[model samples]
Target: MNSIDKLRIVFMGTPEFAVASLDALVGAGYHVVGVVTAPDKPAGRGMKLQQSAVKKYALEKELHILQPERLKNPQFLEELQALKADLQVVVAFRMLPEVVWNMPPLGTINVHGSLLPQYRGAAPINWAVINGEKETGVTTFKLKHEIDTGNILLQERIPIGENETAGEVHDKMKDVGANLLVKTVNALANRTIEEIPQSAASIEEVTFIKHAPKIFTETCRIDWNKKVSEVHNLIRGLSPYPSAFTTLDGKTMKIFSSEKEIAVPTSEPGAYETDRKTYLKFACPDGYIYVKELQLEGKKRMGVDDFLRGYKFN
Candidate 1:
């Protein structure tokens, strides 16, 4: 495992978040022998085939790319075996089969978006914001049979601001994850790191575990029955992506940013109030959520002031 021995690395990822980790590995002089990403699928209005973010970047770097439609395909497996990688790195990617994850000598190391044993599923960044957590961070762990149920390698913590949206936190996590991946790889090369199991005893007296399931349209719909702060956090959690939505004049409106109003509202829950001049506020179980940024159905996103100038929520 000498520094110049050229440890063969394979990277598995699909989205922009994973791209940061891949770039970091390349910049650190790791021998990224191949990349495995999702197959190109039809997307957009024209239904054009689109390559994944990871594939695009791998091509630019002139690295070998593997886009297997099925992980169990014998042909794909053979190609992966031919790479003869020493380690694999996964980031923001799909669940891997045991054969794929266990193929390498040093095993696969995953770059998860949140602290291990917490937010351990598909959408960690969004769920952390949705749950209104004060602090969240990234973790590197060895791959196991279960998703995100691997032994911890290294972790770096970051604070989540009260007013921050999931998108904001996502960008910050990307950078933090890149740096952590570099450190983890260096430690692995030197055989100086220890893997800690994620059982209850391994954590430092933390009990509750938060889950990060994939977001859906149903989950993103604004639940006005919750407290104003809760609803506000939901909006921020899904912002700039699978944004929180509500019905406005029988049309769907996607909410990106909101402010909580603690004052008791005279209107019933789910009711909306607007100055018809510059602000629109929706009543929740306890108070109101002042809409600051949103997009009405078939309309471009706009600020509260601009949205009020043309459309009145009558």
Candidate 2:
């Protein structure tokens, strides 16, 4: 145990992704003095109040928790200041006002989904897979004025399987990210780490930097005009949430998993062929994408064979 054990810390996060990091900190016996998370909101069919995953975990741990409607709220600021945290850790949370981030003596640190200086946006995990990258990783950095433009403290690289979905990568990265976050905190506490500016020469050499903006409805629609690989990547990248979709019988059908065939296409892009029993494949520029898992609008998710059995194209 180093000075970090005695440091008063505040952990801020929301969502399941953040929970793992928080849990790692707690499990490591960090002196977490406070927890801040988003407020409860209505969700689901009943629109009942739903607690954020962090909030629920905080409640179970019986830690001091804050759910401020606004970080700049005077009352919230007063309470936050009272915690007197030596450092604050943020993961998978909303952007913070400088006043909030600058509150602690050691300043704030964030666990970003990307390796930094690349995929710097709201949807790094999804975009990395969507762009067909074979490698993606987690980065921990000191927070500055710009979003994800912070100086790097530590990073851990991980490979993305060629055929893996975004959800699978997310699952793997969350645990890997949790361990890295703990390592970063320990390094910072022990005064053994140095900050590296993101614009350092090594990062600058990458000329074709890609940005990961938030995905939208238009982005999720299958562009059959693209090559089979691109189309396949898009489908896997968006799986399990905000899934890729295409029109079927004038109704929208979401694709969750797919297999690509690189043979020359016989039909126009977006055209499909099905024996109405075993397969449903759509043509693209270079080949066809066989829908392996999917769901029709207003229907439960099912395998392609099951979907083909019940779905009657008119």
Identify the candidate with maximal TM-score: 2
After best superposition, candidate 1 residue 106: deviation in angstroms? Answer: 0.1
Worst 10 residues of 2 by lDDT: 201-210
Name the 10 consecutive residues with the lowest summed lDDT in model 1: 200-209
Query: Which candidate comes out best when scored by lDDT?
Result: 2
Model 1 regions more than 4 Å off: 2-5, 200-207
Could you give candidate 1's per-residue lDDT for residues 1-26 as a string of tens digits? 53524889999999999999999999
lDDT of 2 by residue, 120-176 (tens): 999999999999999999999999999999899999998999899999999999999
Report the lDDT of model 1 for residue 273: 88
**Estimated TM-score for each candidate:** 0.96, 0.98
